[model samples]
Target: MTLHQRPSLQSVPAYKQGKPAAAGASKLSSNESPHSPLPSVLDAISEGLGTIHRYPSIAAPQLTAELAALHQVDPQHITLGAGSVEVAAQLIHAVAAEGDEVMYAWRSFEAYPSLVRIAGATPVEVPLDADSKHDLPAMLAAVTEKTRLIFICNPNNPTGTVVEAKALEDFIAAVPRDVLIVIDEAYVHFDRSAVRADGVELFKNNPNVAVLHTFSKAYGLAGLRIGYAISPLEVAENLRKVAIPFGVSDLAQRAAVASLHAADELSVRINEVVAQRERMYEALEVAGYPVVKSQANFVWINAGDDTLDIEAKLADGGVVVRAFPGDGLRISSGSELDVDRVIAALASVREGAQA
Candidate 1:
């Protein structure tokens, strides 16, 4: 039987977070680091847990202050959320009314389109270029009077492509004043290349632009689900209003604050991931797979792309990666062991092609 559906209740495509692999399998699917929370961060969370019987400081004052100081912005300029993804959704919900349109690049964050839909808004998806980077000009052209929000995911998820600062600056200039622009930089710290947008700097100037950042990536705090948005106070207040109360847990708030001080240590570890990403890219390219220049922790495999089929084969080889149907697989990546595992799995596929 066909199910009756309201426009808001229609089947909005869901974000496909990958399944966890078997205990011994190297899981590289969810873009989660193979690593765990830092020892100090773990200690911080443990300390916070002792106070769990009490409701966390809903304001997250200490955490927010640390974030404000780090970003060189006022605490009032920030709104903490469960993760940067949640912050992104809040930004859309803040500026858009039901049926108003939100625009973003396709295959960017699998979540963006669905999140907009769930907010009772229309999602406009502009396709990425052949190179897999966002076609910003085309996206700008698609913006309409109903376009209340635009999402720009730098070093975009799944595709791992980035918009350089110059291009980003140009794109921002063309955006209408009435529209809210969200720059999702969930994996920014993992990026070492110079060709990337500094959303923080952009937010410091443009009241219309809101930037979402998270400690999940380089800080090894994904489990804490701690992230925040930098926006004008007007926008920040709106986001805070729409947010579910106390979404940022006490432990998460505390751990994220501690993690912020470990940047020097995290940078060294992140550089290692960057090097491994380059190696993974080289290996895939050498084996004749189409790869985008990755500026994120993972590399995208555009395997022409039997994404699901390829994923199954990698699974047999004990490596779990993310598959996006026609877009191929996104290998969340790891150190030498994790990288080598995926390379071997893809290599086996390449060798079989010739057979």
Candidate 2:
């Protein structure tokens, strides 16, 4: 007899990571920081090496306290997870059930649908607007009685588009009090827009709102896998209930704390990434690609029918980018050299098409 599996998983596909670069190619496929860990962060990780045999502090009190102080929230409001994605899963399981619905923008985070499906909840995906930003009005319209959760991915992944502050405020006010709204700010540090929505600020007066943050992106702690959520006291408790025991390793916790304390050093790296992102956006536009103005550490090229062809051309030119088949391509901002390679590759594509 065949071993039993959940019927819901039958249609769900496994998550696909961005492709690794071939020899001599610049890997821009993954939205990862190109910088190495700071000396302070490395020292902290080294100090924790002796504690490997023991399980990490389940509550991660030190890191939790640091995060609370950083966000100006009480420690009770914080919950730690292996990563923000895991925190997202905990949030889904905390409030959603078999028939409950979880809503988000389509082509936002690729993991949303699978996470909801794994929780046995129905996924509600609204399409992005023409500018590739979240269609908040349409998302509000799609909410129903069964809607238990809504995720707004600010500076949305792959597209690098963000919802403005005022519009997001209105959307939050209009959402039902009982429906949990999670503002996933995985790329929050890279967003420098004047009107960018602050998730922590939004969560202050709104008990139904939660803010998710990760050390993976700006802090360059992706390999360590540490992230947290600031939410209502009750929501935090439930999130803790659903989280895996000792999911966050001791080294990750130490690295996150060290990274936070070394904020000045971290800021320099972030500024470098932002600079590169701007350079890339400008170059892509000059090459005749209708690139979106990204506030995150990447730019979106809406390649449409030419996506695959462009992907192949980029490969030939020793550069790699994340392609969304018929939709577009998302190129992570790497070093100055990487941006040069990407510009050269796309220039070749444009020249070939014109020829």
Candidate 3:
């Protein structure tokens, strides 16, 4: 006899990661830092090797304290997870239930719908506006009485588009107090926009608001899988309840703390990534591709029907980018050499069309 699975899972699809690049190809499909780990971070990880047989501190007190000091919040407000994605899942499970609704922007984070569905909650997707930014007004209108949670992916994934600070503030104010709003700022470090919304600042004054951050992106800790959420005390307590025991590894916790201490060194690498992103954006625009000015560590090309073709061309030039079938392509910034390969590939595509 077949094992019975939850009926709600029938509609859920497994999460798809960015496609791995072929040999000799620059892998820009995943938004990851191209830099190697700092010496300090590496040393911290090495130091933790002896403790592998033992369980890590369940509460992750050290990491929690570090993050609290960094964000200038109470340690009680912080909750640790394997990654921000897990923290997000914990948040869903904490607030949402069967027949409850969780809302977020469409084409934002690929994991949002699945996370909501896995919690047996209904998913409500509000379409992004023409500029690919979150349509705060539209999202506000979509909330119903059953809406238990809302996710605002600032500097939204895939598109790398961000909502303005004032607009986000107005939207947060408009959202009903009963509905919890999660400001997922996984890419916040890469954001250099003048009008960026600060999730931590918002969280400080709003009881219903929570901010999600990950060491996976800018910290260059993707492989280590450590992230946290700063939420209200009640929500944080519930997140701890839903979190897998010792999910955050000892090495990950150590690396995260070291990474934080090595921020000055990390900033140099982050600045380089930002430079490459700007260069890629300018080159794509010059090649006649309709690209968005991204504040994150990637550029979004509105390739429309040509999405797949462009993706193939990029691969042909020894570069791989994330493509959303008929929609567009999201190219993560790599080294300067990688940017050269991408521009060269897309330039050839433009020339071929002309021919």
Q: What is the lDDT of residue 117 in candidate 3?
A: 91
* Highest lDDT model number: 2
Whole-model lDDT per candidate: 0.86, 0.93, 0.92
In candidate 2, which residue pairs get closer than 3 Å at backbone N, Cα or C atoms, i.e. clash? none
Better of 2 and 3 by lDDT: 2
How do the residues 77-191 of candidate 3 rate in per-residue lDDT, one tens digit apiece?
A: 9999988999999999999999999999988889999999989899999988899889888999998999999999988998888888899999889999988999999999888
For candidate 2, the C-alpha RMSD (Å) to the true structure equals 0.8
Give one digit per residue, the lDDT tens place, for model 2 in 1-355: 9999888789899988889998888999888899989999999999999989999999889988988888899999999998899999999999999999999998799999999999999999999999999999999999999999999999898788999999999999999999999999999999988788999999998979999999999999999998899999999999989999999999999999999999999999999999999999998898889899998889998889878998999999998888989999999999999999998988999999899
Instruction: Please list the Cα RMSD from the true structure of every candidate, rounded to 1 decimal place.
Output: 1.9, 0.8, 0.9
Where does candidate 1 have its weakest 10-residue lDDT segment? 7-16
Q: Which stretches of candidate 2 lie over 4 Å from their true place?
A: none
Q: Rank the candidates by TM-score, best first.
A: 2, 3, 1
Q: Which runs in model 1 stand beyond 4 Å of their true positions? A: 1-7
Residue-level lDDT of model 1, residues 1-355, one tens digit each, is 9977776555687676677889888888888766766788888988977788887776899988988888899999999889988888888888888889999998888888788888888889999998999899999999998999899998899888989899988998999988888899988987877879899999887868888888888888888788899998999998889887888899898888888877777778888888889999999999988888798999998875577778887998999888878767889868789888889998998888789
Of the two candidates 1 and 2, the one with more favorable TM-score, higher being better, is 2
